[model samples]
Target: MTTAPAGPDPTMQAIGQAIAEGRAGDTTSARQKLLSLWSVIGATGDPLHRCSLAHWLADLYDDPAQALAWDVRALDAADAVTDQRVQEHHAGLHIAGFYPSLHLNLADNYRRLGSFEAATEHINAARTHAPSLPQDSYGDLLRGAIQEVAEAIALRDRSRRASAPGSTA
Candidate 1:
């Protein structure tokens, strides 16, 4: 007989619910809830919470600069996260697998802000971490998006990609 792993984290579940609200087009509620959570978490909170919150918060902003701010915060927090911490919420998850998407988002935001040099650096970082991504739909999506952002950076295009998150109002 084996013991079951711990149940869902209520805080993470709340974050997921807010993220779902955003996905459902009720972004105001999502942003507000996340903001409320942020107040509780403070700046030096759990690395996972900081990383997750900042990443999702970045997606709520239409302005590239604003989005870039949140993305930077996410990346900063990501640096402090441990694989063990990630496994607490997701048994199969590893911190390494998170880098590709995190870097890709930063690259996209920098690209949109006309910071090609910064964007190129982050895109390269994303590609460097790409191998860590699982060979699944999520991996495919990030890989494809990385290519798209890289091409835009090469062309010096400042317009947002239609498929990019935070493109809508």
Candidate 2:
């Protein structure tokens, strides 16, 4: 196998800069820089940096599919490098998904792909990973979301059943 180049990765730094700039004009450059960083970080001898870069790359990508793929990679990298902080944060983030979080992202992806079953599965997965399950407003909100997904799946199933031949109403 061909050996990867050894050095400090300027590409990741460039990606961080471009991302911070937040100019629509810099999106293309930012994406390219992030991709390049992802390629070299694996060989650069730092799993934390690799996981951080992967997380940033996933956040930088606007497309849901692309984001999902990158986030999955970030999670893998975090696990590979044994980032306990990332692991703990990941568990919380998946549940407290109030904003730009992974749980919402994965749920939206499954929804877009028309996999309500998978969407519900992810919602439950998020709940399981939740750091706290206290009976508070936040917990209620989480429960509501899970219930909504469940109801939606039930509705979808009922509709499908109705459309089947000789189905009783």
Candidate 3:
């Protein structure tokens, strides 16, 4: 006899259904519902629930850093259950989503803070994670542009540092 996979908590199941529908174009109340369910999934240490929640949050929210943070937690829970699916999801988010997002956010924040060197570093980091595309795809071109911007900022910072009022150049 085949046994059914144990289902998640009723509340979590409800949140999961909502998140799925939200992804299909229903966000009016989806965000609030997911937020409310986050703590519950987190507390239960349920990898499936946590992974589902993280993916939903990432899509509904534009904050990569926050999404990455959630993904990290989800990964931890997944690890506890020895779940390969959860590991794959976590890796995909990092390799395809969070890394680039964090790179962009870091670059923007550094530029705004007048930390040109820091900005350049983030840009390079982002490039490292960027996906390869057609021989000359738009994403490749964009990544190249970001790299150039970072390099220019790094050079400016270096020049400023060298010219600063200090005993050593």
lDDT of 3 at 73: 55
Task: Please provide, for model 1 over 66-169, each residue's C-alpha lDDT reduced to its tens digit, 9 standing for 90 to 100.
Answer: 88998998999999999888888777688998899899999999988888999999999999999998787888989999999999999999998998875387
Give the TM-score (vs. native) of candidate 1.
0.95
Deviation from truth (RMSD, Å), model 2: 12.4
Off by over 4 Å in 1: 1-6
Cα RMSD to the true fold for all candidates: 2.9, 12.4, 12.2
Instruction: Name the candidate, 1 or 3, with the larger lDDT value.
Output: 1
Q: Pick the candidate with the highest lDDT.
A: 1
Question: Per TM-score, what order, best first?
Answer: 1, 2, 3
- In candidate 2, list every pair of residues with a backbone clash: none
Error of 1 at 145 (Å): 0.2
TM for every model, in the order presented, reads 0.95, 0.51, 0.41
Better of 2 and 3 by lDDT: 3
Compose the digit string of candidate 3's lDDT tens values, residues 66-167.
544554554444344444443443332222333443464445445545677767777777677666322345456556656655655665542222211111
- Cα shift from native, residue 161, model 2 (Å): 30
The models' CA-based lDDT, in order, is 0.89, 0.50, 0.52
lDDT of 1: 0.89
Best by TM-score: 1
